[model samples]
Target: MARIKALVFDVFGTLVDWRTSIARESEQALTPLGIAVDWLAFADAWRDQYQPAMEEVRAGRIPFCKLDCLHRRNLDVVLADLGLDQLNEATRQQLNLAWHRLDAWPDVSAGLHALRQHYRLAPCSNGNISLMVDLARRNDFPWDAILGAEVARDYKPKPTVYLSAADAFDLRPDEVMMVAAHSSDLAAAAEAGLRTAFIARPDEYGPGLGESAATVPVDVSAGSLIALAQALSTANTPP
Candidate 1:
């Protein structure tokens, strides 16, 4: 096979600990407003609406909109559901930007920096470019470019999201590896002819709720991004 020319990562779970970060942010931002609930459960409930909200755009039921707009809508829905719909615009917007402040996993920066020595790196997430940029800057993730839902104007599992990243580098699908924690994302990327890597994120959904490993076949699978970088380095080394 040709050497991997680029690695496109799934940002939310693979690189960042969104569950804890979102929950913490929610508690920090909303508790002072006298809206105290199970913040973790609130985070999960908000996240559960993510894909379905995007599916509206993907299905042409709604026009193309950035993930931030979708996030705002989802946040409102979650707030309404939790009986906390009385927030002002400023408060709502502040809560929405919590997605931008998600903390990266411990291995992410070092792993991406190491992997960048060998191959180009970018986030192939459902997150829009602004969201990606905020997260990247906040977490010190060194991405060569931003690619994903915003670039393709379509969410993942959509062939365009994966293929567009490869296209951005002027490379064939097989030359670009899609690195994600979700088996479904890898499967979709594989279907689009991109190489696939899965990093198990056991705490992505909060402890045991997250995926422990890929259930589908992928070109590479690792416990974390740093391990994947080491494994890839070894694979590329000559005996």
Candidate 2:
């Protein structure tokens, strides 16, 4: 086992619940206009846009884009495809910015605070730097540092994103662990020479989150970052 000096976390669905936060705001943004849409459904659709959008960028069909722009483009497409047309340009932009106001999971702040006492904890997320900073301030996340894919000019699963942080800290790959609710994120971290820890965010994708993203059936699942900190603490002890 390796000594984990720092823990890197995924923001969306891990440190913050993008689905619920965005959907709640989406409802408020659209209800006054009588759009009659399921904001939750729209939120899910917005999240679903991530993979294909990244694929476009990865394939060179699109130029390099930040997660914020990717999210904004998807928001517009979802609104139009769902027949929602009442929003003015400014309002649409406001609605698109729901990404900036994500709510942290119940234990997130407390957990991160507790962990910060022991390790150099920071976010290693695909969100743009400005968006992550705003979210930290909005949600009061006590992260010691904020690492964004935009800083690397690439996204996770690209390898460069993970390595850039390692390069920044002047640490070897094994010294960092990526904590995430999504297994795909953990898998990427593992591939990047970082350790992997899965923190359960059961409601991340809303109430019916499936086994595909759930942790109950996974191998290295942790219920919270507090638990993750405890586990790492134990691992670091001298025998």
Best by TM-score: 1
Q: Give every collision pair in model 2.
A: none
Q: How close is candidate 1 to the true structure, as a TM-score?
A: 0.98
* Candidate 1 residue pairs in clash (backbone atoms < 3 Å): none
Query: Which sections of candidate 2 miss by over 4 Å?
Result: 208-220
Would you estimate the TM-scores of all the predictions?
Answer: 0.98, 0.92
User: Which digits, one per residue and each the tens of the lDDT, describe model 2 over residues 1-239?
Assistant: 45667778888888888887888998898788776677788889999998888878767788888888998888788878877665688888898789998888888888888888877877888888889899889877887777858877777778888878776677787887777888777777788888777887766776657223443232356788778777767766889
Tens-digit lDDT track of model 1 for 16-112: 9998999999999988877778988998999999999999998999999999999999999988887786899999999899999999999899999
Q: Which 10-residue window in model 2 sums to the lowest lDDT?
A: 210-219
